[model samples]
Target: MPKRIQSSGRNIVLSVRDFCEREKDNNAPLIPFGNVRQRVAAKTGISEKTLNKAPTLSSTKAEMQNWIINKGLSYLPTMVKAQLYKIIKEHKEAPIYEADQMLQAHCHKVARLPPYHCELNAIEFMWSLVKRRVANKNVGQETNNIVNLAEEAFQSITAEDWQKQCEHVRHIEDKLRERDVYMDAEMDRFIIELNNESDTESDSSSEDSSDSDYSSLAIHMDHAYSK
Candidate 1:
């Protein structure tokens, strides 16, 4: 295993020896993510066309607010969240996780989870199982007793148990996909009904206006899938 590096130059090839090892894969040049070397900058000659613009980086909090107002945006908090963050985030390169960088140094690529979404994780379901087992079997609240119970609880959940949970999630996903087909047909029907009669809101809505539950249902797939 390669010695894991802790930080920057996680992305950099500082020396010729590193380049030789890296170049063995292919002749693709190391594209540095940070400031270019003076020699490199001179050769490349900064072009007018840039990848992304960082308009808000240097601005104070007050200046960001002013920019929001000048743009005739909505509520302060909402504008900051919906609009301002996009401007700042789009300009930035995503930071590599320290643990991920360390692992990559050892030639093991990590499979990253989608940020903030865990409904698809079978391990989450397995965790609940383990927790429930521990709760049921609790003999004492002592540290070692709890630790032993937790270990046994984890061991009780086999590979097959995990596979079952994965299949459960898959079934839910299949159902949602079928649900999407229904929603798509409904949306098309809605559009057709809206302009079938008149341009005005009253005429558009009143045309074949039967109660539609799509609005009332408000079926959040994320919430449903978690259950």
Candidate 2:
């Protein structure tokens, strides 16, 4: 009806026929994408919950076909199915958080510690020291005594105390690194021995290799605490 209407395209008058001809080559798909329908209102059925409704992983290899069936997708070739899976499981970076912006506004930087590493946290050790001091002084359990003792406990901490806690964390890290090195060496040695045994057995058909050739290491790292 508005075949002669102007101003929408800034000089190109509206033409529904021309628009349909240009878009016929492209079907309306991937509702997340496609054109802006009316320049403002996005089309419906474009939500995350709808897009991510893929099949769950199963013990068998039927999940791929299940995904196709659930999505009403046509039977795809192996290569195309693989590409679809890759797109479905693509690694998406997390959304930018407001915490970063708030920190920048106050001229403060954000320092994130590794997850599940309380021993590596300096503040955790400091809290332990303060709690011990407060427990020793607040024997009467009075409210004011507890508060005063806590304040004194926190004030008693010095630079030397913080340095010791940081040093302790470094020591733990060093021990972990040494243990990793030892484990890697043991694994390499075991693999080499197993391969040699297999080769010897193959060379001499009359004699079978003993199970002891693949036994656990006799000389292991000291385990006084029994792991």
Candidate 3:
């Protein structure tokens, strides 16, 4: 994990090493999620606390929102998530203010969506779908072959199939929105009560949009393969 970006809300550190070890225990298979995690964290250290703080598989939709949107994702408040991410990955030291300004612009341009309304950005499901579709199909062992395989995978699906997938995803999203509305209402009431007691002007913030939720969703997969 990069110490530079670790802060109140924006850090979601992934443990590629543990992910690799877990995959090793299973039969070796093509797992892109674990591979990406390993690639991202190769030079940087993995912090146990950051990874462990992630909600477990059984977490409810409301809990997931509280952890991911309200607390976990640093997209809010700070603003410059993309630049900060670049600094961590590229090992370039830059002003957080620049990143902050960039993020503020993004937030300004986009309307916030409820947490549960964005099933299209659920990366874990996408990884499973991709791996199942591409398993055992060799695009050769060369780099170009790998690139070709990715292109083929995207091109293989029909427009109708894509529409069906998006529709199904949207159905789940509707359910999520209902849950979020109920939860958000309760939270808002609590905040109002607190403010009434304190009698101070509370600062307002926006929720993350559905389209932008892609970057925050975490997917874990095994990456051990014959190399």
Candidate 4:
């Protein structure tokens, strides 16, 4: 069983490092930074001269170009191509589990909720109730007693309460899906309207140009007749 630890910055980093170590021991293909840099250089066909002039990892591509210029080096096509390749590679490799083989190793699947959607987690609701109960209780001064009270608060939430929270989350998911569908339809309509407006404006401009041309021709004919 995983130990229930406080979510401090150092603790979180330690936990991630431990998880990574375990995954590494299991023969997970975790690419190192040096390997990534070498791969980026090889795949991009960027020369060492341009790559050497690049700024720190935190700097943007444009900023890196500026840095290169500051170092009396031009940001050539090779550097720009390398930057693009780096961005594409980073985006493509963003997934935590890259291989389908990794998923086969685990018996039970982990359901990862979308980012910023904490309401979908039944544990969040359970924690809220537990914290409220703990706040109401007068477990004072003793560390062991406070721990006991906190434990008791957690124990108060039943399986039925978890089921209800799950149902609530399903309802929220349905509503969100409905809203997304509506927004997509609205976006399609808006794009069509914009295209129609553009076409109409183009036609009006062409008609105006044609009328101007005709007026100019009439003036030229009049000048010729008078002469």
Best by lDDT: 2
* Residues 25-102, model 3: lDDT tens digits: 886743556665444434234433333344444545444445445443533445344433432334322223334556
- Model 3: runs farther than 4 Å from truth? 1-118, 122-132, 139-144, 184-227
Best candidate (score: TM-score): 2
For residue 38, give model 2's deviation from the true position in Å: 25
RMSD value for candidate 4:
17.7
In Å, residue 211's CA in model 4 sits off its true spot by 21
TM-score ranking from best to worst? 2, 1, 4, 3
Where does candidate 4 have its weakest 10-residue lDDT segment? 216-225
Clashing pairs in 3: 1-45, 9-74, 10-74, 80-99
What is the C-alpha lDDT profile of model 4 across 1-227, one tens digit per residue? 97766556455466556656765797954445577644344434443344554344666777655655554554456666466445434333223432333565766465677889897777787788887887788545465677888888878888898898889889988998999997777555532112223333455467766565445432111122243
Evaluate model 4: give its TM-score.
0.41
* Reference-based lDDT, each prediction: 0.59, 0.61, 0.50, 0.60
Ranking by lDDT: 2, 4, 1, 3
Per-candidate TM-score against the hidden true structure: 0.41, 0.44, 0.27, 0.41
lDDT of 2 by residue, 22-135 (tens): 455566432233445431222232333334445433312366655555555645456455555654454322434456777989999877678998988888999999999999
Off by over 4 Å in 1: 1-92, 105-109, 112-117, 139-144, 192-227
Whole-model lDDT for model 4 versus the true structure? Answer: 0.60
Q: Tens-digit lDDT track for model 1 on 76-193?
A: 5655433665555544445445477779999998875566658767788888989999999885577669888999998788889988999997887788789999878755553222
Instruction: Provide the RMSD of all predictions against the true structure, rounded to 1 decimal.
Output: 16.0, 15.9, 23.6, 17.7
Clashing pairs in 2: none
- Lowest summed lDDT across 10 adjacent residues in model 2 is found at 38-47
Candidate 4 ranges beyond 4 A from true positions: 1-106, 139-145, 189-227
